[model samples]
Structure formats: C-alpha cells, structure tokens
Target: MRNPSLYLLPALIALGANVAVISECQAGGGGELTAAVRHEAELNQISMLEAESLLGQPNVHFFDVNTLEIWAEGYLPGAVFFNVRDWQKLLPAKKDATLVFYCANRLCTASVLAAREVMKLGYTDVRQMPDGVYGWRISGRPVEKP
Candidate 1:
C-alpha cells in the first residue's frame, strides 16, 4: 500500500524548506536514501539490543512507521503508531524524551523519514533503528499488536 505522504514530499521539498519535505511525510518517502541513512547514523542510531531494553519505558518513546497493514502484524510493545495524527499530538509533548523511529528493515525509508521530521522539530535525542522490526524479531524479542 502506498502512503499518501510519499507523493506530497517532493512538492514540499521543492518549497525550499528541508523540514517541510518530511514534516508530514513520516509515513514514508523515497529520495536520496543513502544520505538519509548516513545522516541518521550521524545523528544517532540505536541497536536492537538497546531498543529492546527501552521498551515499555516512559522516558524512551518509540514510533513505528511501517505500513498500517505491516504494523498490524506485529510491533514493539509501547511503540506509537506513527502517522500525521499521533505525531502532531504526542511528539510535541515529549520532545525531550529519547525517541526511536523504525520501520520494516534497514532498506525501508519510513523510519528515516520519521527521524528526519523529528529532528526538524528540534528534537535532540532522536535515533533511528534501521534494523527495525526484522531485527527485533530475529533478536528473539517479543512483539505485540494493539
């Protein structure tokens, strides 16, 4: 399924605002993904082990950016379903908390889109777990769906 945010990103990017491109495109987008990966790594990324440890904690927030159908299958406990609505509501309140963004796998750009958006919001402790749900499952961690 195609996320509607993907189509809007390029137009937003053309408006000359770096953040506007991803601000509402946290669901996913396609572009210079290499740059996204590099930047996410430079900004700060989390390992599966670290992310697992933070699950269910109040100070550490998780955002899952995978497709709704995919996410319906399973996701890390306590992870908020990231779309335009939740981001607008929850992110503003917990901007200072440690935020972890993730999608299906390292190749998936959804997480990167989310991380970039959060960073643009001036979040200091943002991190992307590129390995995503795949890594979490392979690591033998449990998954849940709400």
Candidate 2:
C-alpha cells in the first residue's frame, strides 16, 4: 500500500507556494500595497481641515486624480487635473513642492497610487487626502466645476 503522507506532500507544497506568492504581493511586488507602503501613505495623509488651511498657499498644490469625467463634474478649487498618462510633465519642477493628491472618496485608491508614483519620482512633500473630493464636499468645502 502507498503511504498516505506521500500523497499529501504535493498539496502541502502547493499551499506553500501560494502563501509565498501572497507574501510577495503584500511586499509590493504586485499591485497591492504592502504594510510599509500603507504606513508611509498614512504618514503623509492630510485631514480635510488641514488641507483646507493649506489652500491658496503659494507652495501648496492640489491634484485631482479622478477620471476626466468625474473631474469635470467638480474638484477642489485650484486643483489641477492629473492625467496619469502625462503625470511626469504635469508635476511641479520643484521636488520639494507641497503636492496634495485626491480622488473620489476614502474607498478610492487612485489618489494613493498617484501619490506613490510621485514619491517614487523623489518628491519629498507628497500628501494624500484619502477622504477625497467627496469628503471635501460633505464638509461644505468649496468645489469648482469646469
């Protein structure tokens, strides 16, 4: 008779491999955000009140990373629409410039992704308004429509 343990070995190996893949993805090898990435993003997040205070500041710039259709509906006052295809050219030349990125709402990850891309490009003052434009609107903040 064949050993029962031998038959289970292949299943265990497959499980191990699956676990490894999940670990790699959570480590930023894939599209998912790793713990480190999320922590770093949290560190750079700004409260709606804080963002409001920064408005009109010379060095502060807001970027709306929502789709063009969503952006056209409304956006934070003075916010520039961030085109993912042409992001590199759209950013401020100064790496230290205060950059605030936002999307539709807390559930939206577009702003986080955009902020990460900017951070990778060596921008030091990257900030994310995770509450996004939805929060801004709910808070009775001004929104401009093009």
Candidate 3:
C-alpha cells in the first residue's frame, strides 16, 4: 500500500510556467480537516504581492517547508524551517497566530503538509502560500540566505 500521508497533500496545478491560484486537494480517506484547509485556500490563498504587503504584520508567522537544499539556496526573510524532522521540537509557542506556509513553488505540496501540522498543533489562523520561493523570486522579491 502507498504511504497515506502523501495523499493528504495538495497537488500542483501548473499552467506553463505559472501556477494556477487554486489546485485540487487530496487527503487521507479523502476528507479530513485538511479538506477544510483546501477549501479555505480556494478562497484565501495568498499571493506573493499580497504576502509582501503583510511582511510587517506582528501577528503573522511564515513557515518554510522547502527541502534543506532549497532552503540553503535561500528563503523568505522571516521564514521558519519547520522541517519534517525537527518541527515538533520547534513548534511555535503561539498557537493562535496567523501562519503561512510555502514550499519549492506553486506545484510543491510540502507546504500543505506543514499547514496541516500547524492545524493539528491548534493554530487557527493558517494560510497556505500556494506559490513558494520560486514565485517570490519570479515576483522580484529577494530572499535571505547564508
């Protein structure tokens, strides 16, 4: 049998070099709390420009779920690397803060998993950054890196 977690993640919807704002949602047994997440994304997905505008919002948090290699390449200025292995230990102390998650790009699902993880951790304000760093760069935004 296939690993069930993979099914709960969202799939990328690429249109040529662009990512569709909305993508289909997949999940375990087909409809879990994550299903609500997918639906909310349909209505509230954040754009690179919109996210840029909210950069200074004190209540917002950004989570970077991109692979270590991708992160090493660079990432959003305030992004947090709650990677699969060490996330539990680094869980944000604030459970009610607004959270945004992104992966390699619009097509990547790692962010979706991260979003779900936060929800399980009791975070009520979560938004999936459908377009990850690739979108940021394409939109002319610079990232912070070592």
Candidate with top TM-score is 2
Predictions ranked by TM-score, top down?
2, 1, 3
Q: Which structure is stronger by TM-score: 1 or 3?
A: 1
TM-score of 2: 0.71
- Lowest summed lDDT across 10 adjacent residues in model 1 is found at 32-41
**Cα-based TM-score, every candidate:** 0.67, 0.71, 0.66
Greater-lDDT candidate between 2 and 3: 2
Those runs of model 1 whose alpha carbons end farther than 4 Å from true positions after fitting are 1-41
lDDT of 2 by residue, 65-144 (tens): 99998898899999999966878888899999999999999999999989998998889999999999989988888899
Error of 3 at 141 (Å): 0.6
In model 2, what are the clashing residue pairs, if there are any?
Answer: none
Taking all chains together, the TM-score of candidate 1 against the true structure is 0.67
Question: CA lDDT of each candidate?
Answer: 0.82, 0.89, 0.76
76: Cα error in model 1, Å: 0.3
> How far in Å is the alpha carbon of 69 misplaced in model 3?
1.1
